[model samples]
Target: MTSRPRTLIAVLVLVGITVSLQQTFVIPLLPHLPTLLHTTPANASWAVTATLIAGAVSIPIVGRLADLWGKRRILLACLAFLIAGSAMTALSASLGWFVAGRALQGIAAGVVSLGISLLRDHLAPHRLASATSVMSTSLGVGASLGIPLSAFLAQYADWRLLFWTAGGLAALAGVLVLLVVPGRSRPPGGRFDPLGALMFSSALVCLFLAVSKGGTWGWTGGVTLGLFAGAAALLVLFGAWELRTAQPLIDLRVSRRPQVLLTNAASLVFGFSMLISSLVFTQLLQMPTAAGYGFSESMFVAGLLQAPGGVCMIAMSPVSAMITVRFGPRAALMAGASVVVCGYGFAALLHTELWQLLVCSALVGSGIGLAYGAMPSLIMSAVPVNQTAAANSLNNLCRSLGTTTASAVTGLLLATMSTTVSGHVVPSRTAFTTVLLTAASAALLALVIAAFIPRRRPATTAGPLLATPTAVQRHEPRPTP
Candidate 1:
């Protein structure tokens, strides 16, 4: 209700927008980066993959850091990373520099986690759900809006303008954060778990590299298999380290709570389902019309066609809050996943017409808006206040895991199930259908998972964290969404 909270929320939303926009800036230029940066296409692909891997590794670490250090301080640090990366990218003259800049930009994705935790710390309990909902979906909103805007800038202007704008906005937002966002809380005596972060980050990088590059390297190839095996090994070590550490990166016991555990499982599923729309639908709209089921649209037009989906996400934020308030976040998540399933089902059946695809996208977007908005509330409902940032970050990591898996699955299916049309290889209708069905199935799986999340209780501060190795955090009253 005060000017301060309102300003803080606005500035953080702006940071979210800036962060999401940075993620997509390089996308429009990927096909041409080989020429632009004088590199091989394979090397150029790292521009995208680097950001993905960086974002995944940093999400959890930054969340824990925010809790241990200070939310506002860590947030400002993330903004600085974004601004520096953006400016570096804008000035990049080689593939190596560009990839490095992109990696730094990826680390800024933690601002979303910090923003949610900040809201929890700064706002009244009654305002928490709606504020967090809006903050969470801001990424989707920026992403949806960014796709077309970046495409336009890359085409019409010096492509460097995209990064320049990104840096400028991030700088403005950082200044606002320093002026408007107030207060910091760090529980005394908790140490930063650098070893835990290193093990986890290494595991994630290997896992993401294996998943993202498997199609190019052959799924059964030695390098791909090695990375997967290495990831599994590192993760086992990471878990053991967390269980033994005095101040672990993630509290494994607290994480094992039914609410937190199941929500994370469903978050991964939802992430897979949500991203399939982005990967599958955009291609369907851009393939040559001679392929018999294609629209032959420019990348910009295709992005424009899907723009409604992002709009629907923002439009549904308040609706998601209302649903969470009335029936609980579990119900909202189920409703959202159900909508995604229905949308994917329709896409599987009736994607022949342009309007039909639009309808499918709108439905999926609305569903994702509802689902994404509710996830934070669900995690917050289960974790101690000190661990809110860390827990939410882990949930986001699960979603990222789902997304990387989805990317692999869709890439694998499309590559294998292809046909040569007019002397050029093209993904067959069967591939598209199968991808849609797989996404729908994932959403359906999330619905099944959501059924088991226990109803929340009245709001109470979460119990003491990290008192001992065998400590039991409160399970009965973290408060339902």
Candidate 2:
């Protein structure tokens, strides 16, 4: 591989990591937000919710914009939002300001999808699989590593320093991208679909708000039900509009291809499967030993235990790429999902020791690394070159939807299935077992879905050159097998 591709991949992966950091780093600070900002707990929770809603809204918009404009340009714009938002939060004293800042930070969520698209545009066919694998794995790597790092910082340093650190990292990433990443040549020409973007964002916000807050506000309460109703109505309208629009924000026709549709379906299930381990193990490790099946570990220790999974994810990236190269991405995805099912199966049976949890978490992470890596390759192959960013963004959005659903479902399970221990209610062993089984079932479903992805034709010759107007006009050199 050339040094330029290596440098480009490293920079993009770093940007991906920074974006993931923003997703989880604030989690450790949630409990302290109410006191620090002098607000009610209910209000403080918006710090998290705002980010989630903003991210969902921005992903497709940014992806479409990246395809229309330049990916590198859109990437830099996202980092600027990250830097500015982090700075606002760092300096804020009021809850409103913090939530606003968090919402701004959320806009950076499209970086991973954009990075994958960029790789498709630039890399040679032989190098694309591995480069995209490492890029995708960076998401899990950042999420797992950020938890312990943020916990340590929140414990020892001022909480605002976390945002300050995030800001610094975003700034650094922006500068590196500016220096190393090459700009795209044939930027797709299309008018921005404002109506579609508006409808989509509005519907998503309602859907996400209802899902994320249904437990807190009674699930059947008028507000929650109203939000759900509104989301459904808007989504129907949005779908109709997208179908009619000349230059749609998301190309519905392309997205409906069997490969794209099934890959996205698998992504959602895989996402749920991935999040269950994080939700289950963290609580399992922290419960008091008096609760029969508890480890009573500190938050830091629990996070540290999960760190090995991140390592396994990074280690598996190359293997995933190899699998994608040898067997098509369809086989690699099924293999990954099968591995996840095995991981969850192990967790369901073995809950006695710390080492067992570590092993289980690592197993799940390895599967996720492989599955996540394959998704982009599957989506990109099915869509036209210009639609790569938007398609990947939609896939990423599906995963987010899956994770949100997991949070709601698991929260309800743990809340209802608990035992009392010295005035505190803790999740019972049965509850934990049920969650593991549910996660395993989700992975099994993903495996079934992966089985249906269309098989690729045998390679008779080298793959096509990078898709660009210049390359189209004058035949570019294909990579030698």
Candidate 3:
């Protein structure tokens, strides 16, 4: 296979770094957040939730903007938010200030989804597959490095420095993305859907706030119930509005395609399994030494153990692309989801040993890498080129929704079922076991959806991927079979 253009390759790597760094950058400070801000643990959770919620709300908006205006322009706009937000966070003296900074960091998530959409537009088809895989896999890379690096810095220095570093990184990426990437075909003429944006944003915040704070709010309390009701009603209104608007924020018809529908359903399952199982590992590792199956590893060691999974993901991405090509995206997706089920099954049975946890998690990571790599390809195939950014962003929103569900459900389980063993009220073996079962169930659900993916066999004869081919060399030239 011929190499991809150097500029194209550099842009992918930088975007990957930019996206990954945002999520993991705050891991090291999680433990100290409450004390640092002089707030309750429940209130401190908003620092994390703010960023995730922002990403969930902003993704579709920024994505649609990228499709309408230009991908590069939207990406630069996102980076500007990241730089400004991170710098503000570094200077903040209170919890409210920190949360503001974190909310801005959500814009970085737009960079990730939009960057992936642009890959389909600019890169040759063969090159696009692997490039997509690498960029998607960067989620794992950013997460893995961000945790350990943040821990080391937080342990030795002030946590505020973490945001300072992130700000600098964002500025550098903005320069690179602007200078290196090619411009789009042309800007489409359309105004931003302000009403849809408002409705969607309000709905997302209410739902996420309820889920994030439910642990402390008492599940049946007035606050939780009110938020849930408000979110549900707003989302219903948002859907109705989108359906009636002359120019809808999201094109609902495109989402009705079988390939797009199934890929998104599978993405939700993937998100649930990946986050829940990994968080389970964190709880298991941080358990007291007295627990026969537990260890008291520092935050650094915990991050270190998880690091290999990202490595495994990076190593497996090319293989994932090859599988997508040979057996079509449907079969490859089933294969990936099935593998993830096996990973969760092993976790349930093998938590007695550290080596078992690592091995099982590596299997899970491999499955996630493969499945995530295929999601964008599936979406692009189903939607028009003009809708690539919007469709991909919606797909990402499903993953986020799944993750939010996992976090809330697991937190509820652990909080309600706890046992005091030697004056420390840790989640009992029963609770942890229940979490494992729930994670396994999520994988099984994904596997079932993956099974229904419709087949779209490629044409037997080789031809150019697009109607008019560019000058860049494609990676997979037709075999001389």
lDDT: which candidate is best?
2
How should the candidates be ordered by lDDT, best one leading?
2, 1, 3
Deviating ranges (above 4 Å) for candidate 2: 1-3, 457-481
- Please, what are the lDDT tens digits per residue for candidate 3 over residues 1-481? 2134557656766766666677777865777988898988777888889998998889889888888899888888888999999998999989999999999997678666787777877777668767777777776667766776777778878888888888888888888887777775577656678899899889988988888778788779999999999999998999888777766678776676676788898888778877775577777787887765578787777766777777777776777777777776666567777777888788877787889889877887788778777777677666666677888889888887788788888988987888886788888777888888888888888889988876661331232122222211132122222
Reference-based lDDT, each prediction? 0.85, 0.87, 0.77
For model 1, residues 119-167, the per-residue Cα lDDT tens digits are 8878776677777888888877777778778888888899899899999
Supply the TM-score for candidate 2.
0.94
**Candidate 3 regions with alpha-carbon error over 4 angstroms:** 1-6, 457-481
Worst 10 residues of 1 by lDDT: 463-472
For each candidate, give its TM-score against the true structure.
Answer: 0.93, 0.94, 0.92
Q: Candidate 2 on 1-481: residue-level lDDT in tens?
A: 2359989999999999999988888877877888999998888878888998999999999999999998989999999999999999999999989999999999999899999988887777788999898998888888888887887888888999999999999999999998998875666667799999999999999999999899889899999999999999998998898888778899787788788899999998888888888788888988899887898987777767778878988989989899888887887799899999999999999988998998899999999889888888888776667678999999999988888888888988898898898799888899999999999999999999999887852221232212333432233223222
Could you tell me the lDDT of residue 354 within candidate 2?
A: 90
The backbone clash count of each candidate, in order, is: 2, 0, 0
- Which of the predicted structures, 2 or 3, would earn the higher TM-score when compared with the native? 2
Better of 2 and 3 by lDDT: 2
Ranking, TM-score, top scorer first: 2, 1, 3
lDDT of 1: 0.85
